[model samples]
Target: QLIVVFVSILIAFVAYTSQIFVLWNSLGGAVAHTFFVLAPFNVFIIFIYINYALTCTTDPGTVPPNWMPDQNTHFEVKRSTHTARFCKTCNNFKPPRAHHCSTCNRCVLKMDHHCPWINSCVGFENYGHFLRFLVYVEIGSIYLFALLSNRLAQIVEELHTSQIRPSATEATFLSINMIMAALVIICVGILGGYHVYCVTTNTTTIEGWEKGKTLTMKRMGKIQNVKYPYDYGVMNNLRSVLGPQPLFWLWPRTMSGTGLYFPIN
Candidate 1:
């Protein structure tokens, strides 16, 4: 319920605040520019919601009872990848790269990290949608920043030159929009950059942390040293996660391979 409310408020704030400012700046020129430049954000908005729903609702994949690796050959599996194969809690053979999610109380394939904001674990099945959500938000927030900044600049230029002055209501609306735009851009842009790095480097937040932890554990002689696998170069890694088509990279869709097992470098 807390996550639901947070998501709801975020959506409402973005939609209502943006529309309010647009309506407030209803001059012919402003409306024309915004209609073309800002209207397309509606699609982005829809995508945000769609991706959010898919991420939260879609299971982060679980290994069934007594499940074995695929033997038939659609996805070739390397037996060497199955190193850490047991989960004491689930009392089952945990697949390679699978981790137990305490929140969901299950093992998630290619487990990334549990996101509290979304109230879900970002794992193989819905990782693409999670990335898409970040992309759309950054794009939309940046667009809003551009639009509002231009409007504010125009107002300031005219007022400073003694040509025209904005009314009190107009000034207030512009100020609010500017603040909102700044908030979105700063907050979303930095966060989106982290996700972008994760996608490019073929690592998740959890995986990155585990990499460091594994190094520490190995140094302390707690565990044998093991090299991190699953990196298939830069482009291949992106394609495997974001799908093949460049056009549909930002589109809401599933990734190329199943979440069960992944090919490694």
Candidate 2:
């Protein structure tokens, strides 16, 4: 989980830093450019985080078998439809929102795809970064598209105004730029589509299997259904991803009923 968060932060840093450098170059040695450039990046970062939060997975059956309400503890565990259940695949009880990832060798909460780019699982911890990356990536693509389009337009304008034919080197450069822009557009389309799917349905790739049409337990919490056992509200859902914290929803070993606890019918 920590690894996921670190990797995501790293990715965001790279994107923001690279854009800042570009803006600096465009500003031509103006220190004032820092403010103009950083503000949008900041806004983009927040936007990315909110978008990611909205689409994060909320697995219903992640509660483990050892879980039990602790009356002895200060916090009273509320009776709810949420139950502690077992995953045959994991061969142990799981916390809510946690799912077994064959690649990660353990379950992750609100698990998104294991991003090869980051070399880490996009789980609850770094979900914010994942979403940020998506947003920035789209922004970057748009930026590149505008840049290439403007260059092409300028070339066309030059051709119309002047009798000189296009030079071979200039044409080759334009061709490369067009090709790069096209690739970026395609990649953005695919990523944006997938992100949209994940957001409306609210399931990550690690949790996507449970979102199947048949309404299997594997797919139960993907939709916003009150009938589902673990329909915790937005706060719980968010905590489910970020950390159980005082709630002890994540793996709290010493705490009673950490892994699996019977549901209060």
**Top TM-score hit:** 1
TM-score of 2: 0.51
lDDT of 2: 0.50
Per-residue CA lDDT of model 2 for 1-265, tens digit only, reads 5554674574465444444433333344457755664556566555544544433332222333454434443222213534444456666655545656677566654456665555556655555445545655576546545644655676688679985555565466556645654675588668866765564444566445544543663356644542434435545543434355734432212212333332321
Clashes of 1: 0
> Could you tell me which 10 consecutive residues in candidate 2 have the lowest summed lDDT?
249-258
RMSD to truth, every model: 4.1, 9.8
| Candidate 2 Cα misplacement greater than 4 A, ranges | 1-84, 87-91, 163-173, 215-265
Per-residue accuracy of model 1 over 1-265 as CA lDDT, tens digit each: 5886788577767655655654436435456665775578777778878888888877777777876656542343334673446677888766767788999888888898888878888888889988888888777767666766776788879878977877676677667766876787788778888888888888878878978898998999988978667677778778888888778788878755557776656
Query: Quick one: RMSD of model 1?
Result: 4.1
Q: Enumerate clash totals for all models, in the order shown.
A: 0, 17
